[model samples]
Target: MSEAGDATVDRAHALDAVLLGGPRTLTLRDLAERSGLDLEQVRLYWRTLGLPHPDADEVAFTCRDGEALERLARLLHEDHLGSRTMISLTRALGHTSDRLALWQVEALVEDMATRRDLDDPAARRAVLDELADLAPVLETQLLHAYRRHLAAIASRYSVEFAAGQDVGGDPAALPLARAVGFADMVSFTRRTAGLGSTDLSDFVQRFETAARDVVTQCGGRVVKTIGDAVLFVADDVRTGAKVALELARVLGGDLDVERERGAGGLAEGARGVTPVRVGVVWGRVLSRFGDVFGPSVNVAARLTDIADPSTVLTDPATARLLVDTPGLLLEPLPARELEGIGTLAPVRVRTA
Candidate 1:
């Protein structure tokens, strides 16, 4: 191998050691034997972790892997966890970690390339070099974040449980009575058409960060961010309205000056801040696989599609709930024909 290739392999091994807490010493077969699990069982668990199963003879397993397998085996032996549940748990961890790792590495690469003026390959190399030092910190932070989120979920569930709310249901069943909303950037394609990669990334990141802040501060949670849009949810209509109105006010105001400038035939500003339109609905929704669904979600998305830039729109049901809300003004629009939902009145929401 070339000296560069050898150096890269050595660095990878070093990183593996740091992350796995030791060198890779066990073959797949050895790991199975050490953990008192059969090869097939090992493969099943490994594959569920979103990792490729190595050949039985391949010395790719570390002590950490063996320990994990042993713990899993113990749980199974004691009937503490069913095989299907274990598989599901591992799959969830694997899927989430895969995306989280990729996002962090890419963010690091972007920062390195932009701040250090390095090319992509050089930035990746820098990331690899820094991983040994950063891995432990990253791991700790991941655990901390996961624990906090888990605790919050537990607290929320506990409250409902104490209130005699029905918390038992099929894992894949849809949620009921959720406030679903969508906020989409107006003229996103046009605004970003001329931006370079770095500028575009910055713009999108800025929007997502700002939107998340607004949603969370308003007692709602962002479900996910699609390109040029964000989906959010709250337990009640009031919180959803607050989030939608706040996003429209803050994200839409950016375009106010631009609109005036454009009317006078002036050039756009360099900030690239795009205006957003929001739609919110209070209705039952199906929550599965970390995403929301159902008629409410669809209606919210469709409403967002037709809303004026920098404004919040809601169907009559949500509007009725928000009509008497303090500090909010709901201007009822005439019933209009929505493609799938037919004619329905949508209310424009603003801060009173």
Candidate 2:
């Protein structure tokens, strides 16, 4: 092997030891035997946690791996967690953390390149060198964020559902009744046409940061942010209205179409972030896979598509729910044929 290849391998092993807490010393079968789990069961757990199963005879497991397996076994026997639920939870963690790790690494790489004035390859090597030192701090922060989110969820459900207020829904419909919506950036493709990596990252990060702040401040939860849109949920129609209107207001502006078309599609808005048109609907939705689903979600996206920039649109049903809401006004727009739902009047929601 070349000297560089050997050096790379040494660095990788050193980093693995730091992150996993030891060298890989145990085979798959050893882990199962030591953790008191069946070989197939261990393989299933490993695969479910977003990893390919190691060969039974491959010495790929570390002490930490065996300990983690033991803890998982204890959850099954001592905590009595359902097998399916345990597997699903483990899968969720694996999936989320996988994306999260990649995102963090990319961010660190950008920082490294900018701060050290290195090229991309050098920046990546710098990140690898620094990551071992940063790992402990990052892990602590992750735990803190996890605990805070769990507490917030618990408190929210306890307060909202503890009174036994009926969350009425059709027997065959999607279960949860909540307000779900999308805030889609106008002229997204055109506006972001030729931005370089740094500029593009800044624009996207700014929009995401701003949108997330507005949603959380309005007592709403952000379901997810698509490439050029944000999906959010609120407990009730009124709160949803507030969230939608606030999002439109905060991210407001019509595309400077002439300037955009003329000047390489430079977006017009606060900090060059394009304006987002918002659509919100109050209806039942199925919650799964950390995302919301149902007809209402579709309707919301359709409304967003038809909405003018920096405006909030809603269906008639949702508009009616907000008629008695204070400090809000609803304006009916001309009837238009929504893609799936024939002709219908969409209402504009704005702060009064």
Candidate 3:
């Protein structure tokens, strides 16, 4: 009997093998085979959670280490969270992790631990109950901290808005504070006017969808949508620039949907999609009511206007700050006479 029980233990250990390797980055096929899920089921989860399909070329999946797989599997299976909600929750939780505020981290860690299969039944229940009780308190504390930090930083930079008015604030600003920039669709004046309502809606939806994915992946926040454009803020310049460049690059490369709509799935005669231009500048700003503002904010808007339809442009200050950033290629542009700002030397950013 003891030998039989030992064999069962070995089986449990083998099942834990998935947790051994960090960020397996497995494909849909791999996930399906390992998790006993079908491809369609996995696809549903991805769609529900608004996750991009894993690319064969890119590091498709990852975790801190294989040990995380145990928790991840429980979250996926026992929690019964569909893929879409799971994805959104993952992003939210992941963002929270980036912050160093002790209470927030502790709260998250405590909540996460409740999902584990603990040996002590009484202790497990107490852990979960305590987390549930403390969650709201932790959330409130996090918000207060974020707001105070944002106010302090914005004050430090003496931020000013272009509209000569108050821009809204972001509730999640402190602890894991960041500078975020968003570049958006130009206007209703563009090609959108000629299309039907459904077509126009589809175009706008796709743009927003793609933009959000890029921002989340780059560890930035989308404060809110300003009609045609998105307002994004990142924790720092490198992250902000990467988000902008990625938005431009991904949007530029993905024209299949447009081609399908324009030419009824015919590739040869389909009109190409004109991707949105991106501009990013990083500096501390005032975040209020889910909005961001300041002088660095104004310069970012102006720089966006100067960018080509599918390129990212940044101010000299932002560029200089990123001189040491790895995997970034920065090129000096001819001293362009920027309106109101005068003879600006902006640097174009691309992946190195």
Q: What is the TM-score of each candidate against the true structure?
A: 0.86, 0.90, 0.46
Better of 1 and 3 by lDDT: 1
Distance from true location, Cα of 242 in model 1, Å: 0.1
Best by TM-score: 2
Per-residue CA lDDT of candidate 2, range 285-322, in tens? 88887899999999999998899988999999999999
In order, what lDDT does every prediction score?
0.83, 0.85, 0.62
Model 3 segments more than 4 A misplaced: 1-178, 186-188, 253-274
| Candidate 1 structure quality by residue, lDDT tens digits, 88-161 | 88888788889899989999999899899999878887888998888889999999999999998789778766
**TM-score between model 3 and native:** 0.46
Question: Clash totals for all models, in order?
Answer: 0, 0, 25
Report the C-alpha lDDT of model 3 over 1-352, residue by residue, as the tens digit.
6774566556444433433334346666665555566667555544444456664334455444223334555787898867566566555544453443453444344445445543343333444444445556866886897799688668645643322333236555432334556585544475566786446655665566666777878777687666578878876678898888877766663455565655332222222334667878866577543466776677777777888777888888888888889998898888887766677888888888
* Pairs that collide, model 2: none
Report each candidate's C-alpha RMSD, comma-separated, in the order given.
4.9, 4.0, 20.9
Model 1: residue 144 alpha-carbon error in angstroms:
1.2
